[model samples]
Target: MITRFEELDWQDTPIGELTLRRRTEPAVGQEIYEVRLGDEYLMSSLFTVAEEELSTLGLAAATGDDLSVLVGGLGLGYTAVTALHDDRVTSLTVVDRLGAVIGWHQRLLLPVSAELVEDPRTSLVEDDFFALVRAAPAEGEGDYSAILLDVDHSPRHQLDPTHADLYTVDGLRSLDRHLATGGVFALWSDDPPDEDFLETMRAVFDGVVAHVIDFANAVTGGTSSNTVYVARSRTAGEPASDRPSKAGS
Candidate 1:
């Protein structure tokens, strides 16, 4: 009988808990857990296809100079780092609710993500993404050229329940308000969303499109993949009725 090499027990590192376990021959990648929550898979570097897709969409939407962008969920900072690489982006705002995650990024993940956060155009906001989008400037404020969201595992599989509200009717409406004319909204999902979710996006925006990126293991270089959704705004030549109407006297 043949045996595969077994490594040390999973260690809960500061960045995120990492487990070294063996699975069937078909499943052969490191499993990562969220240390603070325990038993939740945050994500592994093994699958970064979605992250790259997000960067691609964000840059495309930012067609002009001095483009401003808002990215929700810092994660491993893959998407943010990619966004910062573009010179057209004048400002990059990153919002994440977990301080621990931020700490981990600063401590352990800095070597990989520091440039993205330390760049002159980067600003880190420790707050709830929902509140920030909902409470945006009332009117005449400059809207973001792109809003990239990766809060949940995907639209169908959310890591946190509170995030479900983000896809709701009111939630979509609020998201549309934050985009500049001709801005784009991009979402990263572990899997494809349901038909209704797609419909909701269409209702909120004039046009919507979905794109999927396949991934491969960097270690073994095998074929494995993930999906990402990119929804562009229909803001061209359209007046800003998306914002709330002022109260009548």
Candidate 2:
């Protein structure tokens, strides 16, 4: 018997075919977890520096000492696990549109899944992140201290094209309304900084910064990078309700 790898789960979704696979990496001599959407690789346990950074840096940006965080993607649980690493994070809600992905974690098919689900502070919500963020109540205790997004590829590209609107000025403003005062919003993008996306964020939020995280790509044996966009909520503004929806959102 070849003790190399196995296919654990596969499913069909609205956008495309989804797969969960685990394999032994001969080079690294350890098991690796992977998730794929159609023909594209979505995430791998081998490389998660950027994902962890998104949570760490994002939570650090939140002004609140005790944080309530919302993570837009579940992936291999790297991002959410990272968020919990910070003791300041009192609560974390992870939202995903796919139920199969959640099942994997709940079943403990992945290594990190056990920690995430077992934690009392973690809650998993199955929903469309884009619609949820946009439709959230404009203000109230429903707001989160920080929102870390790892759902799509980037603002310019996406796993689901519909995610495009969430990066728009209007969509961002709507999301802002769901943030607690002095909240922080961070996104993990596999691409570099986008000037247009930066401009849109600046108009809707108080401050914005794009961080480039570099990592070695084992497959290509070359350096590769990802970007994390972190922005803050406007603190000293007139009530957000009075603000006009930016044109061309």
| Alpha-carbon TM-score of each model against the true structure | 0.76, 0.91
RMSD (Å) per prediction:
7.9, 4.6
Name the lDDT value of residue 245 in candidate 2. Answer: 29
Model 1 steric clash pairs: 215-224, 215-225
lDDT tens string, model 1, 129-198? 8777777556765388889988787776766666677787788778878888778788877765456677
Which ranges in model 2 have alpha carbons more than 4 Å from their true place? 1-3, 138-141, 238-249
- Model 2 accuracy (lDDT, Cα): 0.86
- Model number with the top lDDT: 2
Show model 1 residue runs off by greater than 4 Å: 1-36, 108-110, 138-142, 218-222, 236-249
Tens-digit per-residue lDDT, 1-249, candidate 2: 244768899999887899999998765667899898888889999899999999988988887568899999898999999999999899999999999999999999998999999999999998898888878674454579999999888998888888888889999988998888778999999888887788888878865788889898776778888999988888865433344323120
C-alpha lDDT score of every prediction, in listed order? 0.67, 0.86
Model 1 TM-score relative to the real fold: 0.76
What's the lDDT for candidate 1?
A: 0.67
